[model samples]
Target: MAKKAKKIDIRSDGREFDELREIKIQAGVLDQADGSARVDWGITMKRIAVSEKTYNKVESLREQFYIIPRGKGGKKYLVDVPAKLLDKIGDEFGDYEVVGEHFKGNVAIVAVHGPREPIPRHVADPYRAVLRFRYTMAPFSVPERKRPAPGRREIEISKVSREALQGVVFANEYPMTAIDIFAELLSADAGTRVTAITAASVALADAGIPMKDLVAAVAVGRAYGHLVADLTKFEEDAPDAVDFPMAVVPRTEEITLAQMDGRIAKKDLDELVELGIKKAKEISALQRQALKEKYQRVVENEQ
Candidate 1:
Protein backbone atom coordinates (compact mmCIF):
# COMPACT_ATOMS: atom_id res chain seq x y z
CA MET A 1 0.00 0.00 0.00
CA ALA A 2 1.17 3.57 -0.81
CA LYS A 3 1.99 5.72 2.23
CA LYS A 4 -0.12 8.86 2.79
CA ALA A 5 1.77 12.09 2.31
CA LYS A 6 2.24 14.23 5.40
CA LYS A 7 0.71 17.69 5.46
CA ILE A 8 3.07 20.66 5.61
CA ASP A 9 2.18 24.02 7.09
CA ILE A 10 3.95 26.56 4.84
CA ARG A 11 3.18 29.85 6.55
CA SER A 12 3.72 30.33 10.25
CA ASP A 13 2.55 33.95 10.48
CA GLY A 14 -1.08 33.06 9.64
CA ARG A 15 -1.23 34.87 6.29
CA GLU A 16 -3.10 33.32 3.42
CA PHE A 17 -1.11 31.98 0.50
CA ASP A 18 -2.24 34.75 -1.86
CA GLU A 19 -2.49 37.49 0.75
CA LEU A 20 0.16 40.22 1.00
CA ARG A 21 1.60 41.68 4.17
CA GLU A 22 -0.13 44.74 5.62
CA ILE A 23 0.87 47.89 3.72
CA LYS A 24 0.33 51.52 4.67
CA ILE A 25 1.25 54.38 2.34
CA GLN A 26 1.11 58.15 2.66
CA ALA A 27 1.80 60.70 -0.09
CA GLY A 28 3.19 64.25 0.17
CA VAL A 29 5.04 63.37 3.34
CA LEU A 30 7.80 65.93 2.70
CA ASP A 31 7.13 69.63 2.18
CA GLN A 32 10.45 70.61 0.63
CA ALA A 33 10.36 68.13 -2.21
CA ASP A 34 8.11 68.64 -5.21
CA GLY A 35 6.56 65.29 -4.31
CA SER A 36 7.19 62.71 -1.61
CA ALA A 37 5.72 59.49 -0.20
CA ARG A 38 6.32 57.07 2.66
CA VAL A 39 5.41 53.39 2.59
CA ASP A 40 5.30 51.01 5.55
CA TRP A 41 4.97 47.48 4.27
CA GLY A 42 5.26 44.39 6.45
CA ILE A 43 3.62 41.96 8.82
CA THR A 44 1.64 42.81 11.94
CA MET A 45 2.53 41.00 15.15
CA LYS A 46 0.37 40.68 18.21
CA ARG A 47 1.34 42.67 21.31
CA ILE A 48 1.01 40.83 24.58
CA ALA A 49 0.89 42.38 28.00
CA VAL A 50 3.37 40.96 30.47
CA SER A 51 4.40 41.62 34.04
CA GLU A 52 7.52 43.70 34.67
CA LYS A 53 9.31 40.61 35.94
CA THR A 54 8.58 38.76 32.71
CA TYR A 55 9.74 41.69 30.56
CA ASN A 56 13.08 41.76 32.33
CA LYS A 57 13.89 38.27 31.15
CA VAL A 58 14.02 39.46 27.53
CA GLU A 59 15.34 42.98 28.14
CA SER A 60 18.67 42.18 26.54
CA LEU A 61 16.86 41.21 23.30
CA ARG A 62 14.49 44.14 23.38
CA GLU A 63 15.77 45.41 20.06
CA GLN A 64 14.36 42.39 18.30
CA PHE A 65 10.90 42.98 19.74
CA TYR A 66 8.70 46.05 20.00
CA ILE A 67 8.59 46.74 23.76
CA ILE A 68 6.44 49.41 25.27
CA PRO A 69 4.69 50.19 28.55
CA ARG A 70 1.06 49.14 28.66
CA GLY A 71 -0.10 52.33 30.35
CA LYS A 72 0.87 55.09 32.74
CA GLY A 73 3.29 54.42 35.60
CA GLY A 74 4.97 51.64 33.62
CA LYS A 75 3.48 48.92 35.83
CA LYS A 76 2.92 46.47 32.99
CA TYR A 77 4.57 46.06 29.60
CA LEU A 78 3.46 45.20 26.12
CA VAL A 79 5.75 43.46 23.71
CA ASP A 80 5.05 42.90 20.04
CA VAL A 81 5.99 39.29 19.94
CA PRO A 82 6.81 37.17 16.93
CA ALA A 83 4.97 33.90 16.41
CA LYS A 84 8.04 31.82 17.15
CA LEU A 85 8.75 33.49 20.46
CA LEU A 86 5.13 33.37 21.54
CA ASP A 87 5.28 29.64 21.97
CA LYS A 88 8.11 29.90 24.47
CA ILE A 89 6.93 32.93 26.51
CA GLY A 90 3.17 32.84 26.13
CA ASP A 91 2.70 31.09 29.47
CA GLU A 92 5.26 33.17 31.33
CA PHE A 93 3.25 36.40 31.35
CA GLY A 94 1.05 36.61 34.46
CA ASP A 95 -2.63 37.17 33.61
CA TYR A 96 -1.56 39.00 30.44
CA GLU A 97 -3.93 40.07 27.72
CA VAL A 98 -3.47 40.43 23.98
CA VAL A 99 -3.22 44.20 23.96
CA GLY A 100 -2.79 45.15 20.28
CA GLU A 101 -0.48 44.71 17.33
CA HIS A 102 2.41 46.42 15.58
CA PHE A 103 3.90 46.32 12.13
CA LYS A 104 7.41 45.06 11.46
CA GLY A 105 8.66 45.32 7.94
CA ASN A 106 10.16 47.56 5.26
CA VAL A 107 9.76 51.33 5.60
CA ALA A 108 10.57 53.31 2.47
CA ILE A 109 10.48 57.02 1.72
CA VAL A 110 10.66 58.47 -1.78
CA ALA A 111 11.12 62.04 -2.95
CA VAL A 112 10.68 63.40 -6.46
CA HIS A 113 12.25 66.64 -7.68
CA GLY A 114 11.98 68.64 -10.86
CA PRO A 115 11.51 68.91 -14.48
CA ARG A 116 14.62 71.03 -14.31
CA GLU A 117 17.72 71.40 -16.40
CA PRO A 118 19.91 68.30 -16.35
CA ILE A 119 23.26 68.54 -14.66
CA PRO A 120 26.12 68.83 -17.20
CA ARG A 121 24.18 70.40 -20.09
CA HIS A 122 25.60 67.90 -22.55
CA VAL A 123 23.74 65.00 -20.92
CA ALA A 124 20.28 66.41 -21.65
CA ASP A 125 18.30 64.69 -24.37
CA PRO A 126 16.75 66.84 -27.09
CA TYR A 127 13.57 64.77 -27.45
CA ARG A 128 12.68 63.77 -23.89
CA ALA A 129 13.45 64.40 -20.25
CA VAL A 130 15.88 62.08 -18.51
CA LEU A 131 14.77 60.03 -15.49
CA ARG A 132 17.28 59.40 -12.72
CA PHE A 133 16.70 57.19 -9.70
CA ARG A 134 18.76 56.92 -6.55
CA TYR A 135 18.07 53.99 -4.22
CA THR A 136 19.69 53.98 -0.81
CA MET A 137 19.31 52.35 2.57
CA ALA A 138 19.82 53.87 6.00
CA PRO A 139 22.83 52.67 7.98
CA PHE A 140 20.42 51.18 10.51
CA SER A 141 17.96 49.80 7.96
CA VAL A 142 18.96 46.22 8.64
CA PRO A 143 20.08 44.42 11.78
CA GLU A 144 23.73 45.16 11.07
CA ARG A 145 24.89 48.66 10.27
CA LYS A 146 25.27 49.04 6.53
CA ARG A 147 28.03 51.13 4.93
CA PRO A 148 26.80 54.59 3.99
CA ALA A 149 27.78 54.28 0.35
CA PRO A 150 26.16 53.30 -2.91
CA GLY A 151 27.13 49.70 -3.38
CA ARG A 152 26.63 47.51 -6.45
CA ARG A 153 23.21 46.31 -5.21
CA GLU A 154 21.92 49.85 -4.75
CA ILE A 155 23.21 50.87 -8.19
CA GLU A 156 21.49 47.94 -9.86
CA ILE A 157 18.15 48.59 -8.10
CA SER A 158 18.32 52.25 -9.09
CA LYS A 159 18.82 51.33 -12.72
CA VAL A 160 15.89 48.91 -12.75
CA SER A 161 13.60 51.33 -10.87
CA ARG A 162 14.35 54.12 -13.35
CA GLU A 163 13.51 51.79 -16.21
CA ALA A 164 10.31 50.66 -14.49
CA LEU A 165 8.77 54.14 -14.49
CA GLN A 166 10.30 55.41 -17.70
CA GLY A 167 7.47 54.12 -19.87
CA VAL A 168 4.75 55.77 -17.76
CA VAL A 169 6.16 59.32 -17.62
CA PHE A 170 5.40 61.78 -20.37
CA ALA A 171 9.05 62.70 -20.84
CA ASN A 172 8.48 64.35 -24.25
CA GLU A 173 6.46 67.14 -22.64
CA TYR A 174 9.54 68.39 -20.83
CA PRO A 175 12.49 67.88 -23.08
CA MET A 176 16.02 68.83 -22.06
CA THR A 177 15.29 68.36 -18.34
CA ALA A 178 15.76 65.86 -15.58
CA ILE A 179 13.36 64.24 -13.13
CA ASP A 180 15.22 62.91 -10.12
CA ILE A 181 13.73 60.29 -7.80
CA PHE A 182 15.26 59.45 -4.45
CA ALA A 183 14.16 56.34 -2.54
CA GLU A 184 15.44 55.59 0.94
CA LEU A 185 14.80 52.45 2.89
CA LEU A 186 14.50 53.26 6.57
CA SER A 187 13.82 49.68 7.64
CA ALA A 188 13.99 46.46 5.68
CA ASP A 189 12.92 42.84 6.05
CA ALA A 190 12.46 41.83 2.44
CA GLY A 191 10.95 43.23 -0.76
CA THR A 192 12.69 46.58 -0.28
CA ARG A 193 12.97 47.17 -4.03
CA VAL A 194 9.26 46.67 -4.63
CA THR A 195 8.42 48.90 -1.67
CA ALA A 196 10.63 51.63 -3.11
CA ILE A 197 9.11 51.32 -6.56
CA THR A 198 5.57 51.45 -5.19
CA ALA A 199 6.38 54.57 -3.14
CA ALA A 200 8.22 56.30 -6.00
CA SER A 201 5.20 55.99 -8.29
CA VAL A 202 3.04 57.77 -5.75
CA ALA A 203 5.68 60.46 -5.14
CA LEU A 204 5.81 61.20 -8.87
CA ALA A 205 2.05 61.60 -9.03
CA ASP A 206 2.07 63.78 -5.94
CA ALA A 207 4.64 66.02 -7.64
CA GLY A 208 2.09 66.71 -10.41
CA ILE A 209 4.10 64.89 -13.04
CA PRO A 210 2.04 63.78 -16.02
CA MET A 211 2.09 60.03 -16.37
CA LYS A 212 0.21 57.37 -18.30
CA ASP A 213 -0.52 55.37 -15.17
CA LEU A 214 0.92 54.46 -11.78
CA VAL A 215 3.26 51.48 -11.70
CA ALA A 216 2.71 48.90 -8.96
CA ALA A 217 5.08 46.15 -7.96
CA VAL A 218 5.11 42.92 -5.95
CA ALA A 219 7.20 39.79 -5.47
CA VAL A 220 5.72 36.36 -6.21
CA GLY A 221 7.56 33.12 -5.78
CA ARG A 222 7.54 29.53 -4.61
CA ALA A 223 8.27 28.64 -1.00
CA TYR A 224 8.13 25.30 0.69
CA GLY A 225 6.61 23.53 -2.32
CA HIS A 226 3.84 26.13 -2.57
CA LEU A 227 3.46 29.14 -4.85
CA VAL A 228 3.23 32.29 -2.77
CA ALA A 229 2.19 35.80 -3.75
CA ASP A 230 4.58 37.74 -1.50
CA LEU A 231 7.64 36.00 -0.16
CA THR A 232 8.85 37.12 3.28
CA LYS A 233 12.47 36.96 4.36
CA PHE A 234 11.82 33.55 5.88
CA GLU A 235 10.29 32.27 2.67
CA GLU A 236 12.98 33.87 0.51
CA ASP A 237 15.62 32.00 2.43
CA ALA A 238 13.89 28.65 2.11
CA PRO A 239 15.85 25.79 0.64
CA ASP A 240 13.62 25.56 -2.42
CA ALA A 241 12.79 29.20 -2.96
CA VAL A 242 12.17 31.20 -6.10
CA ASP A 243 12.01 34.97 -5.72
CA PHE A 244 10.54 36.82 -8.69
CA PRO A 245 9.83 40.54 -8.43
CA MET A 246 7.84 42.36 -11.08
CA ALA A 247 6.49 45.86 -11.65
CA VAL A 248 3.37 46.34 -13.76
CA VAL A 249 1.25 49.18 -15.13
CA PRO A 250 -2.24 48.32 -13.89
CA ARG A 251 -4.36 49.88 -16.64
CA THR A 252 -2.45 48.49 -19.59
CA GLU A 253 -1.07 45.51 -17.68
CA GLU A 254 2.35 46.19 -19.13
CA ILE A 255 5.23 44.55 -17.32
CA THR A 256 7.91 47.16 -16.65
CA LEU A 257 10.32 45.13 -14.58
CA ALA A 258 10.82 41.40 -14.13
CA GLN A 259 13.62 39.74 -12.18
CA MET A 260 13.97 36.12 -11.08
CA ASP A 261 16.50 34.85 -8.59
CA GLY A 262 15.84 31.12 -8.39
CA ARG A 263 14.92 28.51 -10.93
CA ILE A 264 11.41 27.19 -11.44
CA ALA A 265 9.49 25.13 -13.98
CA LYS A 266 8.15 27.06 -16.97
CA LYS A 267 4.57 26.27 -16.00
CA ASP A 268 5.15 27.52 -12.46
CA LEU A 269 6.82 30.68 -13.78
CA ASP A 270 3.75 31.51 -15.87
CA GLU A 271 1.46 31.10 -12.88
CA LEU A 272 3.71 33.21 -10.70
CA VAL A 273 3.73 36.06 -13.23
CA GLU A 274 -0.05 36.03 -13.36
CA LEU A 275 -0.22 36.11 -9.58
CA GLY A 276 2.16 39.11 -9.49
CA ILE A 277 0.05 41.08 -11.93
CA LYS A 278 -3.06 40.48 -9.85
CA LYS A 279 -1.33 41.63 -6.69
CA ALA A 280 0.02 44.68 -8.48
CA LYS A 281 -3.53 45.82 -9.18
CA GLU A 282 -4.28 45.80 -5.46
CA ILE A 283 -1.17 47.87 -4.79
CA SER A 284 -2.18 50.30 -7.53
CA ALA A 285 -5.47 51.01 -5.78
CA LEU A 286 -3.64 51.88 -2.56
CA GLN A 287 -1.37 54.25 -4.45
CA ARG A 288 -4.32 56.06 -5.98
CA GLN A 289 -6.08 56.27 -2.63
CA ALA A 290 -2.98 57.79 -1.02
CA LEU A 291 -2.83 60.48 -3.70
CA LYS A 292 -6.53 61.21 -3.19
CA GLU A 293 -6.10 61.54 0.56
CA LYS A 294 -3.26 64.02 0.06
CA TYR A 295 -5.39 66.19 -2.18
CA GLN A 296 -8.29 65.95 0.25
CA ARG A 297 -6.03 67.15 3.03
CA VAL A 298 -4.97 70.12 0.92
CA VAL A 299 -8.61 71.04 0.34
CA GLU A 300 -9.32 70.82 4.05
CA ASN A 301 -6.33 73.02 4.86
CA GLU A 302 -7.50 75.70 2.43
CA GLN A 303 -11.03 75.62 3.87
Candidate 2:
Protein backbone atom coordinates (compact mmCIF):
# COMPACT_ATOMS: atom_id res chain seq x y z
CA MET A 1 0.00 0.00 0.00
CA ALA A 2 1.23 3.49 -0.77
CA LYS A 3 1.77 5.84 2.18
CA LYS A 4 0.09 9.22 2.55
CA ALA A 5 1.89 12.54 2.54
CA LYS A 6 2.72 14.34 5.77
CA LYS A 7 -0.08 16.51 7.11
CA ILE A 8 0.25 20.02 8.43
CA ASP A 9 -2.18 22.63 9.78
CA ILE A 10 -3.18 25.10 7.07
CA ARG A 11 -3.26 28.85 7.66
CA SER A 12 -4.55 31.82 5.70
CA ASP A 13 -0.97 32.76 4.93
CA GLY A 14 -0.28 29.14 3.87
CA ARG A 15 0.93 26.15 5.84
CA GLU A 16 4.26 26.47 7.60
CA PHE A 17 6.96 25.30 5.18
CA ASP A 18 4.62 23.39 2.93
CA GLU A 19 6.23 22.82 -0.44
CA LEU A 20 8.43 20.38 -2.30
CA ARG A 21 11.94 20.32 -0.83
CA GLU A 22 14.55 21.73 -3.16
CA ILE A 23 18.27 22.59 -2.90
CA LYS A 24 19.69 25.86 -4.18
CA ILE A 25 23.09 27.58 -3.94
CA GLN A 26 23.55 31.26 -3.02
CA ALA A 27 27.06 32.65 -3.49
CA GLY A 28 29.37 34.37 -0.97
CA VAL A 29 28.10 32.86 2.27
CA LEU A 30 31.63 32.70 3.59
CA ASP A 31 34.87 34.33 2.44
CA GLN A 32 37.34 31.98 4.11
CA ALA A 33 36.56 29.03 1.87
CA ASP A 34 37.86 29.13 -1.66
CA GLY A 35 34.22 28.21 -2.30
CA SER A 36 31.35 28.47 0.19
CA ALA A 37 27.56 28.78 0.46
CA ARG A 38 24.48 28.12 2.59
CA VAL A 39 22.34 24.94 2.30
CA ASP A 40 18.65 24.82 3.17
CA TRP A 41 17.36 21.27 3.60
CA GLY A 42 13.58 21.66 3.69
CA ILE A 43 13.25 22.25 7.42
CA THR A 44 16.97 22.28 8.23
CA MET A 45 19.67 24.85 7.47
CA LYS A 46 23.50 24.95 7.20
CA ARG A 47 26.37 27.08 5.81
CA ILE A 48 29.47 25.36 4.41
CA ALA A 49 32.40 25.78 2.03
CA VAL A 50 36.11 24.86 1.59
CA SER A 51 39.29 26.90 1.85
CA GLU A 52 43.00 26.19 1.07
CA LYS A 53 46.06 27.81 2.62
CA THR A 54 49.82 27.43 2.62
CA TYR A 55 51.72 25.58 5.34
CA ASN A 56 53.64 28.68 6.30
CA LYS A 57 53.65 32.02 4.63
CA VAL A 58 57.32 31.10 5.60
CA GLU A 59 58.38 27.55 4.37
CA SER A 60 59.66 25.80 7.49
CA LEU A 61 58.08 22.48 6.65
CA ARG A 62 60.12 19.28 7.02
CA GLU A 63 59.70 18.97 3.26
CA GLN A 64 59.32 21.62 0.61
CA PHE A 65 55.85 22.06 -1.02
CA TYR A 66 54.56 19.61 1.57
CA ILE A 67 51.71 21.74 2.98
CA ILE A 68 52.20 20.09 6.35
CA PRO A 69 55.92 19.57 5.63
CA ARG A 70 54.35 16.10 5.46
CA GLY A 71 51.02 14.54 4.57
CA LYS A 72 49.47 11.80 2.45
CA GLY A 73 46.13 10.60 1.03
CA GLY A 74 43.23 9.49 -0.87
CA LYS A 75 31.84 10.25 -9.06
CA LYS A 76 29.08 10.36 -11.02
CA TYR A 77 27.10 10.29 -14.22
CA LEU A 78 24.04 11.85 -15.76
CA VAL A 79 21.59 10.34 -18.22
CA ASP A 80 22.14 13.61 -20.01
CA VAL A 81 25.85 12.82 -19.75
CA PRO A 82 27.40 10.55 -22.33
CA ALA A 83 28.47 6.94 -21.75
CA LYS A 84 31.93 8.45 -21.34
CA LEU A 85 30.89 10.42 -18.24
CA LEU A 86 34.15 9.66 -16.46
CA ASP A 87 36.12 11.11 -19.33
CA LYS A 88 33.75 14.05 -19.38
CA ILE A 89 34.23 14.92 -15.68
CA GLY A 90 38.00 14.67 -16.07
CA ASP A 91 37.91 16.96 -19.07
CA GLU A 92 35.84 19.45 -17.18
CA PHE A 93 38.20 19.36 -14.21
CA GLY A 94 41.23 19.98 -16.40
CA ASP A 95 39.63 22.71 -18.50
CA TYR A 96 38.14 24.48 -15.53
CA GLU A 97 40.16 26.67 -13.15
CA VAL A 98 37.78 26.49 -10.19
CA VAL A 99 35.53 23.52 -9.36
CA GLY A 100 33.05 25.51 -7.28
CA GLU A 101 29.68 25.38 -5.46
CA HIS A 102 27.89 22.00 -5.07
CA PHE A 103 24.86 22.06 -2.74
CA LYS A 104 21.65 20.09 -2.12
CA GLY A 105 18.96 20.12 0.54
CA ASN A 106 16.48 17.86 2.32
CA VAL A 107 14.53 19.06 5.37
CA ALA A 108 17.80 20.26 6.95
CA ILE A 109 21.01 22.14 6.13
CA VAL A 110 24.70 21.02 5.71
CA ALA A 111 27.86 23.05 5.17
CA VAL A 112 31.31 22.01 3.92
CA HIS A 113 34.44 23.40 5.53
CA GLY A 114 38.19 23.58 5.06
CA PRO A 115 41.41 22.00 3.79
CA ARG A 116 43.29 24.72 5.66
CA GLU A 117 45.85 25.05 8.42
CA PRO A 118 48.98 22.88 8.57
CA ILE A 119 48.64 19.55 10.35
CA PRO A 120 47.71 20.18 13.94
CA ARG A 121 50.47 19.21 16.38
CA HIS A 122 48.07 16.70 17.92
CA VAL A 123 47.21 15.01 14.63
CA ALA A 124 50.84 14.06 13.96
CA ASP A 125 49.46 11.24 11.84
CA PRO A 126 51.71 12.33 8.97
CA TYR A 127 50.36 10.00 6.31
CA ARG A 128 47.12 11.95 5.80
CA ALA A 129 45.13 15.10 6.52
CA VAL A 130 42.36 14.69 9.07
CA LEU A 131 38.74 14.84 7.93
CA ARG A 132 36.53 15.64 10.88
CA PHE A 133 32.71 15.62 11.20
CA ARG A 134 30.64 17.41 13.81
CA TYR A 135 26.87 17.39 14.43
CA THR A 136 25.18 20.00 16.61
CA MET A 137 21.47 20.52 17.05
CA ALA A 138 20.13 23.94 17.98
CA PRO A 139 18.09 23.81 21.20
CA PHE A 140 14.94 25.18 19.59
CA SER A 141 15.23 22.96 16.54
CA VAL A 142 13.06 20.28 18.02
CA PRO A 143 9.87 20.54 20.08
CA GLU A 144 10.27 21.11 23.82
CA ARG A 145 13.87 19.97 23.82
CA LYS A 146 16.27 21.67 26.15
CA ARG A 147 19.66 22.64 24.81
CA PRO A 148 21.77 19.71 25.82
CA ALA A 149 25.47 19.12 25.62
CA PRO A 150 26.78 16.77 22.97
CA GLY A 151 26.56 13.13 23.93
CA ARG A 152 28.77 10.16 23.17
CA ARG A 153 26.38 8.95 20.48
CA GLU A 154 26.67 12.17 18.46
CA ILE A 155 30.47 11.99 18.84
CA GLU A 156 30.54 8.40 17.59
CA ILE A 157 28.36 9.21 14.59
CA SER A 158 30.66 12.12 13.77
CA LYS A 159 33.69 9.80 13.70
CA VAL A 160 32.00 7.24 11.47
CA SER A 161 30.77 9.97 9.16
CA ARG A 162 34.31 11.28 8.91
CA GLU A 163 35.37 7.83 7.78
CA ALA A 164 32.74 7.93 5.04
CA LEU A 165 33.74 11.47 3.98
CA GLN A 166 37.54 11.01 4.17
CA GLY A 167 37.22 7.95 2.00
CA VAL A 168 36.65 10.44 -0.83
CA VAL A 169 38.62 13.57 0.25
CA PHE A 170 42.17 14.15 -1.07
CA ALA A 171 43.96 14.72 2.20
CA ASN A 172 47.55 14.49 0.94
CA GLU A 173 47.83 18.06 -0.30
CA TYR A 174 46.67 19.56 2.96
CA PRO A 175 49.05 17.31 4.85
CA MET A 176 49.01 18.48 8.45
CA THR A 177 45.98 20.71 8.00
CA ALA A 178 42.58 19.43 9.06
CA ILE A 179 39.46 19.60 6.95
CA ASP A 180 36.82 20.08 9.63
CA ILE A 181 33.18 19.90 8.51
CA PHE A 182 30.52 21.39 10.73
CA ALA A 183 27.00 19.97 10.21
CA GLU A 184 24.62 21.94 12.40
CA LEU A 185 21.22 20.32 12.31
CA LEU A 186 18.76 23.20 12.71
CA SER A 187 16.09 20.55 12.06
CA ALA A 188 17.40 17.15 11.08
CA ASP A 189 15.26 14.96 8.89
CA ALA A 190 17.45 11.91 8.02
CA GLY A 191 20.00 11.47 5.25
CA THR A 192 21.92 14.39 6.74
CA ARG A 193 25.27 12.66 6.39
CA VAL A 194 24.81 12.12 2.68
CA THR A 195 23.91 15.79 2.26
CA ALA A 196 26.99 16.75 4.25
CA ILE A 197 29.23 14.83 1.84
CA THR A 198 27.49 16.28 -1.20
CA ALA A 199 28.01 19.82 0.09
CA ALA A 200 31.56 19.24 1.38
CA SER A 201 32.98 18.52 -2.08
CA VAL A 202 31.71 21.85 -3.43
CA ALA A 203 33.37 23.66 -0.54
CA LEU A 204 36.60 21.78 -1.27
CA ALA A 205 36.59 22.91 -4.85
CA ASP A 206 35.87 26.49 -3.79
CA ALA A 207 39.03 26.23 -1.72
CA GLY A 208 40.70 25.27 -5.03
CA ILE A 209 42.12 22.07 -3.60
CA PRO A 210 42.96 19.51 -6.25
CA MET A 211 40.74 16.48 -6.36
CA LYS A 212 40.53 13.41 -8.57
CA ASP A 213 36.73 13.51 -8.79
CA LEU A 214 33.40 14.56 -7.30
CA VAL A 215 31.63 12.35 -4.72
CA ALA A 216 27.89 11.85 -4.19
CA ALA A 217 25.88 9.74 -1.76
CA VAL A 218 22.33 8.82 -0.70
CA ALA A 219 20.45 6.66 1.82
CA VAL A 220 17.78 4.12 0.91
CA GLY A 221 15.73 2.45 3.59
CA ARG A 222 12.92 -0.10 3.95
CA ALA A 223 9.95 0.26 6.23
CA TYR A 224 6.82 -1.91 6.14
CA GLY A 225 7.78 -3.19 2.68
CA HIS A 226 7.88 0.33 1.20
CA LEU A 227 11.04 2.08 0.04
CA VAL A 228 11.59 5.74 0.79
CA ALA A 229 13.53 8.38 -1.22
CA ASP A 230 15.13 9.89 1.89
CA LEU A 231 14.21 8.68 5.34
CA THR A 232 13.22 10.98 8.19
CA LYS A 233 13.39 10.49 11.97
CA PHE A 234 9.71 9.58 12.02
CA GLU A 235 10.19 6.78 9.50
CA GLU A 236 13.47 5.67 11.07
CA ASP A 237 11.64 5.10 14.35
CA ALA A 238 8.97 2.91 12.82
CA PRO A 239 8.49 -0.46 14.45
CA ASP A 240 9.71 -2.35 11.41
CA ALA A 241 12.66 -0.82 9.64
CA VAL A 242 16.20 -1.66 8.51
CA ASP A 243 18.68 1.19 8.71
CA PHE A 244 20.85 1.06 5.62
CA PRO A 245 23.23 3.90 4.74
CA MET A 246 25.56 3.90 1.77
CA ALA A 247 27.94 6.39 0.15
CA VAL A 248 29.24 6.18 -3.39
CA VAL A 249 31.03 8.17 -6.07
CA PRO A 250 28.61 7.71 -8.96
CA ARG A 251 30.96 8.58 -11.82
CA THR A 252 33.22 5.69 -10.82
CA GLU A 253 30.49 3.19 -9.88
CA GLU A 254 32.49 2.69 -6.69
CA ILE A 255 30.86 1.97 -3.33
CA THR A 256 33.23 3.33 -0.72
CA LEU A 257 31.11 2.87 2.40
CA ALA A 258 27.92 1.08 3.45
CA GLN A 259 26.41 -0.18 6.68
CA MET A 260 23.15 -1.88 7.68
CA ASP A 261 22.09 -1.61 11.27
CA GLY A 262 19.00 -2.87 13.15
CA ARG A 263 17.21 -5.98 11.89
CA ILE A 264 17.45 -6.83 8.24
CA ALA A 265 17.36 -10.06 6.23
CA LYS A 266 19.66 -10.85 3.34
CA LYS A 267 16.92 -10.12 0.85
CA ASP A 268 16.29 -6.73 2.48
CA LEU A 269 20.02 -5.99 2.51
CA ASP A 270 20.23 -6.69 -1.20
CA GLU A 271 17.27 -4.45 -1.83
CA LEU A 272 18.78 -1.64 0.21
CA VAL A 273 22.14 -1.86 -1.53
CA GLU A 274 20.53 -1.92 -4.95
CA LEU A 275 18.29 1.00 -4.16
CA GLY A 276 21.07 3.02 -2.58
CA ILE A 277 23.33 2.59 -5.59
CA LYS A 278 20.56 3.53 -7.96
CA LYS A 279 19.51 6.65 -6.12
CA ALA A 280 23.08 7.73 -5.44
CA LYS A 281 23.85 7.56 -9.15
CA GLU A 282 20.82 9.66 -9.96
CA ILE A 283 21.82 12.24 -7.36
CA SER A 284 25.40 12.24 -8.63
CA ALA A 285 24.30 12.93 -12.15
CA LEU A 286 22.33 15.99 -11.05
CA GLN A 287 25.34 17.29 -9.13
CA ARG A 288 27.54 17.02 -12.20
CA GLN A 289 25.07 18.84 -14.36
CA ALA A 290 24.54 21.53 -11.76
CA LEU A 291 28.27 21.98 -11.27
CA LYS A 292 28.93 22.29 -14.99
CA GLU A 293 26.22 24.90 -15.26
CA LYS A 294 27.47 26.68 -12.16
CA TYR A 295 31.06 26.72 -13.42
CA GLN A 296 29.95 28.06 -16.75
CA ARG A 297 27.88 30.79 -15.18
CA VAL A 298 30.70 31.90 -12.90
CA VAL A 299 33.05 32.07 -15.91
CA GLU A 300 30.62 33.92 -18.12
CA ASN A 301 30.05 36.48 -15.40
CA GLU A 302 33.80 36.97 -15.09
CA GLN A 303 34.09 37.57 -18.84
* Candidate with maximal lDDT: 1
Over 251-278, each residue of candidate 2 has an lDDT whose tens digit, in order, gives: 6767766765566667867766777777
> Which candidate gets the maximum TM-score versus the true structure?
1
**For each candidate, what TM-score against the reference?**
0.83, 0.63
Each model's C-alpha lDDT? 0.84, 0.51
Q: Which run of 10 residues does model 2 get worst, by summed lDDT? A: 73-82
- lDDT score, residue 279, model 2? 74
Model 1 TM-score (2 dp): 0.83
| Model 2 / residue 236 / CA error / Å | 1.9
